[model samples]
Target: MKYAILTADEPFISLAELKSLLNNENNIYYFSGIAVFSGDYKNIARRSSNIKAIGEVLAISNDPKDINEVIRGKCFTIKPNVILRSDKDRFNALYSTATKGVIFSKKCETLDLIFTDGIIIAGLREEERDSKSLLLHAKKPYSQSGTMDAYTSRLMVNLANPKKTVFDPFVGVGSILIESAWIGYTCLGADIDINMLEKTKYNLKYFGYTCDLLQSNIATNCIKKTDAIVTDPPYGKSVNAKTIKIEELYEKLFSISSEILSKNGRLVFATDAKYDWRDKIKEYNLSIIGIHFIYLHKSLSRAIYVVQKR
Candidate 1:
């Protein structure tokens, strides 16, 4: 069994991302902030933005015998969770269970156990998220007023379930492309403005990456096939779409994506919550897999849509 301790913020998006990347979705159980599921734990953890820690589940049972079997003769520590936080008696009982043939010290602990949903889950933490690297959006070599943040960029790419290649039609400063390349994908980016393409190139080069860059419009039909199309198109006054309206741009994107994307390929993009593209999506024979909303403030909310070609 595998386990993932997810971040508490916007957990629905985290769940959607985990579900998209992992198989055997039916068996996945989420309790509190932890997710118990079956998949490639290392692959999912490396690409994940919301998963804090992931590893194998050694023991999962309410009975102390099950817990004792794993903790005995091992140096471990018990991490507090929602259950133990509110119930002191439960924490004491758990501490007593770990003291049997076990040396418990915070500094000397080699393994960790978390009690949640009336059960103790003990495991060897294989990977922990790099909090500093995930917040390095501002430190990029090139950035503009409206460049997407690193966390959201990685989340959008993961929602696409990308295999080998990821394409971003409106690759402003290569936000999506940067995250995709970092996650071991062949990145391809295109934008109508030559200046923006140059900025993307400079930023990607700073990170020691070289991706295929093109100066073209979103309506272009000559682009090569890609496994996933992940982008954040021009939106609001911060971005200027000179040639076509935003609605028309999405329609063209949906139309072109249906033709160029590989079989069952995903087109993951973000737009304002006010815009409705269901009609356009249907007209292009695409299927809507998921839509997650992130509220910016009282007046604005961003809608992320995950659509796949049939």
Candidate 2:
């Protein structure tokens, strides 16, 4: 069995990202902050932005006594969930007695002990996300006011489950394309504004990444069939929404995405949560995989949708 520790702030989105990327796996159980499943999940920790850690499940039990046996001679440190705070002292004592290495010392692995839904899950750490890399957003050469942070952009790209090519019709500053290209995908991007396309090219080149850029409106352009479509369309601003209404832009997006995506390909996009898009999805013959909402502030929230071809 495998386990993943998801980001706390956007747990549902994290779970959706995991499911979309690991569609072939069987999820045995999951809650807000953790998931236990069985699958051939290798390098998933690095591939995902929301998953904090991914590793093999060492043991699971209701009794805390079993931990002593599990940690015998193991050079590891125990990390418990917030729910297990009351038992922290007890867990510490057990670890002190059973562990072969000093706590917090080098070469000591981390053991994730989470209590969720009346079960205790123990997972040994194998891989973890590089939290420092999230700071790359501010370091990027070109960014507009609403440019997505690196973590969120990477999460959206992973949700699309791109196998080869990733197309972003509304490539604003190339946030999505940067992540897709970084993941070794053949990236294709289009924008109605030639200036935005130039900024995307400059920003991508800053990272030594390359992508096909086109200065064509998504509503009229016909892109070659791509394995996935991951994009963040214009919201409602001069820097973003350009001439079209948000509603009409989304309608065009759905129409073009349906025509350009290959069979079984996925479409992952973000939009304002105020508009209802379920009907448009059905009309476009797309199957809904998941929808997650993130509130940015008191007045704004973004809805991310992941859908696959029917």
Candidate 3:
């Protein structure tokens, strides 16, 4: 079906992730703080002939009144193709005259909304209640930004095809690992910090995941051959060791990942440091597939690199 995946502000990064997830000819729309019509969205449609642009901006809001205002006067010709509710906003309600006055209330907040034929059809929400069921909650830590919201994680995991085992070397809190396990893949997680490793174990246990958890440095760890490696390395600002420099860390990561990653296997990770990771990837004989920039905070922009064994 022809559809678009909507992303929030600092969309460069989110758009990258969305592109990885969608991985198709559909349109991708971006906005700043949730407004319908933005220049970026139009650009996306223009750049990708497969996509069509339609502007109807909405933000993640808890206030019912604010949500009502966001959609109250907004025109809907046939209800909506989909209505995605994010965890940040829980007031999910949809109306369509063609469906005999149908209304739906999803369990989680919506992060992405998809509409078609002037009716809400798809709504992406945070999987807080049965978060364990959501594949994204697997190896993610409990930290605010370390974890992917249930909706996005689910979408990514669904898009990813894991023929062999999946490994996360920098599994902070095991969010990605847990998600991989939930999706019926044998997964492994490794972290240098014992404390973070313990936390990952605790969170995985809490979520009832029994994946392999190891304590080892990514640079020197003995990793198994695997299908893919997906991770969110330390941003080098708050979580990483204060003593080590970011450049040194990247060098170590390149050396270790190149040694352990299997041929044809993919490596996907995000980093805020603007060091030339492309050069490092080439040095390691890895083929660069894509690089996406995601905005985490106001000033921090993370570059998510996707590469494969050469």
lDDT of 3 at 45: 30
User: Which scores greater on lDDT, model 1 or model 2?
Assistant: 1
Residues 202-265, model 3: lDDT tens digits:
8778777777888887666667477777777776555556677667777777776677777766
lDDT of 2 by residue, 250-308 (tens): 88888887888999898898887886799888899898887888888777788888888
lDDT of 1: 0.81
Tens digits of per-residue lDDT, candidate 1, 106-155, equal 77644557677677777767777666666765479888776788988999
Query: Per-residue lDDT for 248 in model 3?
Result: 76
Give every collision pair in model 2: none
TM-score of each: 0.90, 0.90, 0.59
- Better by lDDT, candidate 3 or 1: 1
Mark the regions of model 3 whose C-alpha exceeds 4 Å error after superposition: 1-78, 81-160, 239-242
lDDT against the true structure, per candidate, is 0.81, 0.79, 0.54
Worst 10 residues of 3 by lDDT: 42-51
Better of 1 and 3 by TM-score: 1
Q: How good is model 2 by TM-score?
A: 0.90
Q: Compared to the true structure, candidate 3 yields what TM-score? A: 0.59
